[model samples]
Target: MGTEKKEIVGMIRGCIKTVTCGQKLDLNHKSQNDVVKPLYTKLAYVLGLRVSPFHRRQGIGFKLVKMMEEWFRQNGAEYSYIATENDNQASVNLFTGKCGYSEFRTPSILVNPVYAHRVNVSRRVTVIKLEPVDAETLYRIRFSTTEFFPRDIDSVLNNKLSLGTFVAVPRGSCYGSGSGSWPGSAKFLEYPPESWAVLSVWNCKDSFLLEVRGASRLRRVVAKTTRVVDKTLPFLKLPSIPSVFEPFGLHFMYGIGGEGPRAVKMVKSLCAHAHNLAKAGGCGVVAAEVAGEDPLRRGIPHWKVLSCDEDLWCIKRLGDDYSDGVVGDWTKSPPGVSIFVDPREF
Candidate 1:
């Protein structure tokens, strides 16, 4: 009876990795030819390992990890990987030491709280929802060379969970429309505006619920008080509803790229548009991941309290014959300017 607790003790989860074409990924931050040669390989991601406190030291966690790896192997995965906070030494040691893995990409997590008050979409910025075809065209035309870009981009865009890709351009570029809505995305793309940015939104809330644990009592109280004061005194105007300490949903922004001097401003407007979408859907926060040195980092909305600067991702090759050829030993590659966070992966 003392051998185990009356609860689920250990667990681990795995998902297919983001697929890539055979050609080399260009990290130069320059646009590339739209042609992509298809190549198929099995790469999977493993994460969300947990073991009950009372069941520690019994090797339950190790067993779970091993089982997941075997499942990946059975599914024809050539490589498997995992991720954790850079500062989480326990996770690092467990993955890199006990398990056979090596240090990989170090991407930053940017999270911005959704304010109860709607963000004002700039009048000068006209954000239009691009049809799926147009969005894919834009991505291929501009960001096909981005690192870690998903090979099945069309499927991701068509996924119901995706709200839709959006484009932000100068309002002056929108001709003959008072509401500033442009439906003919194809024609518009043919003769594009002077400046523009494109991004897509995915509803992450449908995947799982998130809660903040291990916070000071004072912090919780202060957060609760703010929410209450806002509700009790509407005129006072509160920042956001519901403390993140409680279970909350999230909206993820991806494929953020643009051109021209006003690119950054367009990104901000899209962020505002994203925030509004998140708030309407009852999501408490918006999150995005990009290279640590991305120039666009200064433009995206994010809060320090809910963000992680150096998120560590680790990987391991399951077999020796697995050829990375054009991809190279990504574990050895330097961080690039932009990293495409596939909506399907998030």
Candidate 2:
């Protein structure tokens, strides 16, 4: 029995790489170089190769990456990609020039104040808390907008975590007046107790005002009906529904990141609504992650670049037959694109 247990342990150890950390390594005896390798799994990401500084410019980097690509292909990665800073010329050259990886997507992080005062008073819109029954209506509006992931609506109904979702109905519409104006022209205003505090206060106030305004008669009717249902159906014991005046959060995965007119309009409405919610919710800050370049930084001079970090780029070769493609405007092609979100989130 002891011998059998030892054998099992040895086999398990051999099957998995021994490591102080989770990262993998490639040993090149021919070149006498140690290459830090990226391991690819169906669920895990494959990171890019990092050559030792001492072995720099010796073609080791290329060799190591090729090996990693092979590993990815064998593990069945549908696609692989790499990311580098816009300023890092050498790394960029190696990937695009030598390794033949094309530009996939650019991601940036943007923040907005939740307070009314931080936002331009002229562009302010209203935000409201939603009830469970409102989920279907919100879903329809979101789908019509074509601005979010398809699964988002389902996820909402299923009761996910602290994720706050809301709808931006314009003031006169059946949904009510949502945040108006584009965020591109709007500037991020800074306040004391940090910016987030001010934004939260603003959201709470804005939500209260919208509720008092009776901006949408249909919404008011719905609210009253919902109340009647709650009182009559004692067994239901439903959760407290969010009123129209409460501000909420928005998460945009794809549609609003670009620079086209539609993208701008969507972002504008989103920001306006987000600001209103922030004020009404009395939440201090509203946050958004923008891809490509920092539009607010580039467009608005006063907005500062807070922090930037590169996500790890990993790839493994799934098959020997794979080819990235003949270059020249690969973004138009289907396989030419790659989408990445945090593994934990996915």
Candidate 3:
């Protein structure tokens, strides 16, 4: 029941960085804070929040968030968090200042354009579609311990929006061959290939219609020009970003990670595979959100201009268990290997 404010790594609204952490907070700059990871605790994420235009400046949003937090506390949730764009100052202030939810993470939302030409998957890499059960088992084994992983992965993998889960591995290394029961996590990880990557694809085309408004004329010109040039000259392989000016669909790839030297190769191939899938489905973009420090960020292909380099996440503790009197705040502890960006939140 203690409402203490503390800064971690992600996003929160404030009076802005000039508001004081002993330094000016710059949304454009990446945070250098150590990873403050989870210990498999109970938590809830806030999403789909909106207020009527008539409710503006009436402290309605703040009250609503407080009420939700009370509900979370009543339900025994140990923590609650909110995610928003870094440039959204109003949202930042509402949470970080008024609501006492300090910054938690600065993950980037990586967005890749779906070009007219298909992105090629490497020949040496074999892409395999996974059964939902098998995919669930694998996720639990690997990512269940990571941040932002859903409470129930089975529901996510089985949801209609989830296209399927896929794994990229060196060719001739198919593990799930026979029609036997899923062998659980240990066996799946047992004798794994030297290099491998796994990810799930979620179709966001139907749920959200996103458009980029008020773009500078030059940016618009560049986006349009790139599309035209790419379409007109198929072999040129231009680095054209997606045209987000109009409403567009997005395919979100989540639970991404890999091992071994060629793991990066597998991830890139999987991204290309995802790009091809999105293009065929008429989605304008293939997207993902990864912790800024996750090496996977370097592997996933995306356009810099089209992506949000520093989207923020803010978290509040429902109780005082998050702190240890002897060692300072647990929020400043080292983070996990990678953050599990649950597409369900989007």
By lDDT rank, best first, the candidates go 1, 3, 2
Per-residue lDDT of 136-168 in model 3, one digit per residue for the tens?
888876666575666578888999999999888
Instruction: Name the top lDDT candidate.
Output: 1
Whole-model lDDT values for every prediction: 0.78, 0.36, 0.75
CA RMSD of all predictions: 4.5, 20.1, 10.9
Local distance difference test, candidate 2: 0.36
Ten contiguous residues with the weakest lDDT in model 3: 14-23
The C-alpha TM-scores of every prediction are 0.82, 0.39, 0.80
Report residue 178 deviation for candidate 1 (angstroms): 6.4
Candidate 2: deviation at residue 92, Å? Answer: 1.5
Sorted by TM-score, highest first, which candidate order results? 1, 3, 2
Please give, for residues 1-346, the per-residue lDDT of candidate 1 as tens digits. 4676566888888886545423543455456654444333457887588888888878787788889998988877777878788998978988898888898778889999887667888899877887788788777666766766776788889888899898888887763244645646556667777888888999999998799889899988888887777667766555754668889999999999888888888999999999999989999899998878888877897878779998888888776545445455555666667778776666
**Ten contiguous residues minimizing lDDT sum, candidate 1:** 20-29
Q: Which ten residues in a row have the lowest lDDT in candidate 2?
A: 191-200
Q: Which scores higher on TM-score, 1 or 3?
A: 1
lDDT of 2 by residue, 72-189 (tens): 5565543445645666777777766787676645555444433233343223223344443444343333222221122233333434332344333234433234333212111211
